[model samples]
Target: MTQVKKHEAKLSRAVESIQPSGIRRFFDMASSMENIISLGVGEPDFTTPWSVREASIHSLESGRTSYTANAGLIELREAISDYMEERFDVSYRPEDEVIVTVGASEGIDIALRSVVDPGDDVLIVEPCFVSYAPLVSMAGGQPIPVPTFMKDDFQVTLETLQEKITPKTKAIMLSFPNNPTGGVMGREDLEKLRDFIIEHDLVVLSDEIYAELSYDQEHVSTAAIDGLKERTILISGFSKSFAMTGWRVGYVCAPAAYAAAMLKIHQYAMMCASTMAQYAALEALTNGRQEMEEMITSYRQRRNFFVKSLREAGLSCHTPGGAFYAFPSIKASGLSSEQFAEQLLLEQHVAVVPGHVFGEGGEGHIRCSYAASMAQLEEAVDRIAVFMNTIKKEG
Candidate 1:
C-alpha cells in the first residue's frame, strides 16, 4: 500500500488561507429550511431579461455551440469596447485589448496569476471583496489589506495607499461602486489613485462589475485616466447589471501587450468562456441597456427602503450613494459583527453577512443586500427591528 507523503498531507497554505465565502453559510442553512427570506445574497434578483436569453437560444439553435477563440468571440469583445467607450468614456482596441473570461471571477484570477510572481506585495483596499486577498495569496503574492475608513464613507484615499505602499508592491485591487459598503469613489479619488500609480509604476486591477449599480452618481472608470490606461486592467461583466450571473460572461481590457500575456494564461486555465454565454453577452451589450436601467431603478427603490428602515431599526446605517448593499453598524448591539449576524439569524430568522467577513476595518458592521423584493425586505426590516428591541430591553 502507498502512503501519502507529509508534504502532500493536505492542501498548501495558499489553498488553506483561501477560505469559503462567509456569506454562503447562511445559504446552506437556509436551503435546509423553507420559508426563510434572505437578503444576504449580493446579486440582482432578476433573471437574465428576455432579450439576452433569446440571444443564447438563437446562438445554440444556429450551431454556435463550439469552443470560441481562447480570448473569446470578437463580436463580444467589440461590443465590450464600444460599451465602455459610450458609457465610461474609456477606449480600448477590441482585438488587442480585450479577452473574454468565464466571468469577472476568471478575469480577476487570470489577471493576478499573469502578473504576480511569488512574494510580490498586492495591496487591497478594505473592506473589499472576499475573493481579492485569497486570490492574491493563491498566486503566491503577499496580500496586504489597506483599511478604508467607514467615517470617510469607505473611499480609498491616497493617504492609505501611501501608508501601505512599499518597494515590493506589484498591484492594487480596486472594487468601486464597491460591494459590502455600497460606497462609490468619484473622479477626484480616481485621479489621485491614477497619479499615485503613475509615480510608483504600480499596476491597477479595477473591478467594475458593479459599475452599473451606482445610484447617486455616474460610475467612474479608473482606466479613463491618461497614462494610467496603459497599466490598468478593467474587469467587468454582464452579471450584476444585466441579471446575467448565470450566464458567466465577462471580459478584461488592458494594454495590448498585457492583454496578450494574460490571454495566454487564461487560455491554459479556462480555454474559453461559454460560447452561448458570449453570444448572450453580445445581445446584453447591444440591447441590454434598457434592462440595466430597469434593474438599477428597482435597486434604487430597494436601497432607499433598506437604508431608511435600517436606521429606524436601531442600526446606524450609511445611505450609500451606489450599489444595493447597506453597511449598517451593529456596534450598538454590544456584539461583534459575527455575533450580531448569528443572533439575527437565530432569533430574527434573518440572514446578513458580518462586515468582518470582508476584512479588518469591517469589524463592527453587518452587510444587508437590498437586492430582494420590497415585501421580503419590509418583513426582514420588521423582524430585525423587533430583534434589536428585544436585545436592548435585555441590556
Candidate 2:
C-alpha cells in the first residue's frame, strides 16, 4: 500500500469520519489575499480588559506559574460560583459542582464524553457554534442536528425538539446568544422546553459564552430555568466577553454527579487550565465589569450600523439581538452561500463566512461579524453593496 494510504489507515476512524471546520477554510483564504476586509472571525476585536491582563502579570511576577488543582484554583471556582449566582440567578458549588477548563471548548468535550455512551443520540440546535456536532461525534455519540430557522429568529421550539427525540436520545446541546445567527432565547421562549426536558429526563449542554454580550435584554441562563439545573451542564468562557481569546480559560457548572464524571476525564487529559489564566479570570470576576460594559456598548453601536447597512444594501437580515454577527440572506444575488462569500472575497476584497458552514439551516445566508472597527464595517458594507450591484447587472 502507498505510504499516504498506510498513514490514513493508522488514523482513528472516528477522527477520519468528522469534517474539518469550514469556517477556517474561508479565514485561511482571506489571509492569503491582500486588502481583504474580513468579518469572518467570531471573537471580539477588543483587547483583553486591562485589569484582567494586569492580574496575569502580577501572577507571573509573584512566581505563580505552577499548575492549579485539577478542578482549578479554589478561589477562581468560588468566584465563578458567586458571579453566576449574583449576575444570572444560577448557583453552583465551587467545591464539587464547578470545574475550570482549558476553554469552554474543553468543557464541552469533557461534558459530552462524561454523559454519552457509544451510539447515543445528542440533539444539537443549529445554526450553532461549529464545534458542537464534531465534539458530539468525537465522544462516540450520534449528533442529531435539530435545525432552527431565521423566520423563528433561530429559537429552538418544543415542537421541533419533540420531532427529533427518540429512545436513543441522550442529551441536547444549546448555544445562545447563538454563534453565527446571533439569536438569544428569552425566558418565555426557554420556558417552552421545560416540560419536554422534564419528560425526557435528558441532559442539556448549554454553551453561553456570549452571555454578557446580548443587546437590549439580559441573557437567560438555561440552567436558571427550574428543573434544568440538575440536568444542564453550563459552559462559558472569557474569550468572547472579556476579549481574552488567548487566555485559554473557561468553565463548566454542572450538578455534582455530572461534574465528578467530567472531572475524571479532565484530570487525566488536561491536568489543569493555565494557572495564570485562572488568576486573570478571578480578577475579571472581581473588577472587570465596567470594562466589559464599555466593550458591549461599542459592539451594540457597531451591530446597529452594520445591520442597517446590510438591510439598505437589499440583503434581508434579522437584526441580531445578541453576539456580534449579522446573518444576511444573500439569495437575492442568485448565489449559494459559498458562491456569494467566495465571489465577494475575490471581487470586493471582503471576507465573510458562508452561512452553510454553520449548519444546514444556514444556507442562502452569510455571517458578517460586526466585531471589526466601524471604519472597516462601513468599508465592508460599501464593498458588499458594489458586489451586489455587480451581480445584479450580470443577472
Candidate 3:
C-alpha cells in the first residue's frame, strides 16, 4: 500500500498576507526578560474602578449570567446613548442604532466586514493602531494608507485624503486620539474631513476609544459633524477611559441601517458582549465618572512629564494632545525605530514599540506609552537617556 504524502495546509491568502502585531512581539520579548520597565502596551496601570468591579460582582451574585440580546442589554445601550450625547455630542437611538460588542476591536471588525466587499478600498490614516490595516485586509478590502506626518501633528488633511481616494474607496477608518502617534483632530479639522467624506460618499468608521482622554481640547465626534452622521459608524469602549481592558466591553453607534448590518454580523460571530462586562460598563457610565476623570488627570500629568523627559533625553517628541503615548523621533540616535527599540530593550531593559509597526510615515520614530506609574516613567526615562548617550557615542 502506498503511504499518503502529507502536505502543508493552505491558509487563506488574506491571513497569509497579514503580519503579526508588532506591539505584541515586543511585549512578548519584554515578558521573557527580568527587571524590564515596559512602556509598550497601552493599558492603564490603574485598576478598574472599584465601583465598576463591584457592579460586575453584584451581577454574578444576582445570577444574570445568561447571554444578552445580540444588541445587548437595552439599559446599557440607553446609558451608552446618553453618554455619547453628553460627552461627545453624538446622539443615536439606543433601541436600534447601538450594539454592545466584545470590545471596540470587535466593533471595528464587524464594521469592516459589514461594508467592505472584496477588493474595495478603505483609507486608513496612519500612523495608527496596528489593528486597522490588518483588519481591513482580513475583510478582503485594500488597506490604503494615507500617511500623516509630524509636521501636521499626524492629523489627516483633505489634501492627504484626496491623494488616496479612488472610486472604489468605500470607507475611511479614523482613530483619534490615535494610538501610536497620539494625534487628535479638532472640530475644524474634522469639518474638512466631513466635506471630503460627503463628496466621496464614503462611510466613516470613527474609532473614538480615546475620546474621553483628550488633554488639550474636546474630542469632537466625527459623526457629530454636519452631514457626516448618516454615514458614520462610531466605535468606542470602556477599555481606555474606564480602565476596562480585561473586561472586553465596547460598543458601536451608527445610523439605523449600518447598525443593523453590523448587528447581524455580531449576532452570529459574538452573540453579545459578556453579560457581567455589560453590567460593569453600565455602572461605569452611571457612577464611575469621578474615578474615570481622576485617571484622565493622572494620564495628562504623565503625558506632560514623559514628553518633556523624552525631549531632554535628546529625542524629539511632539506633545501628544490625547491618549497616553509619546511618538518620539529616534532618528537622532542614528538607528531605525526597530533597532533603537531592540537595543534599548537589550541594554537598558526598557521596552517601547517601534513606530514602523503602525505603518506608513511611522519609521524613524518609537512609541512609548505613558500609562505606567510615575515611578516607572522616571526610571524608564533615565534608562533611555543612558541608551541615547551610548548610541550617540558609537555614532
Q: Pick the candidate with the highest lDDT.
A: 3
- Ranking according to lDDT, highest score first: 3, 2, 1
lDDT of 1 by residue, 179-215 (tens): 8899888887788777789888899999999998999
TM-score of each: 0.96, 0.97, 0.98
Report how far residue 237 has shifted in candidate 1, in Å. Answer: 0.3
Give the winner by lDDT: 2 or 3.
Answer: 3
Cα lDDT tens digits, model 3, 1-395, are 99999998999988998888888878888999999999998888989999999999999999999999999999999999999989888899999999999999999999999999999999999999989998999999999999998888989988988999999999999999999899999999998777779889999999999999999998899988999999999999999999999999999999999999999999999899999999999999999999999999999999999999999999998899999999999888889989999999999999999999999589999999999999999999999999989988887
The RMSD of every model to the true structure, in order and in angstroms, is 1.9, 2.2, 1.0
Cα lDDT for residue 228, model 2?
84
lDDT of 1: 0.89
Candidate 2: tens digits of C-alpha lDDT, residues 202-222:
999999999999998999999
Model 1, residue 205: C-alpha shift (Å): 0.4
In TM-score terms, candidate 2 sits at 0.97
| Model 3 misplaced stretches (Cα beyond 4 Å) | 5-7
Q: Which pairs clash in the backbone of model 1?
A: none
lDDT of 2 at 87: 87
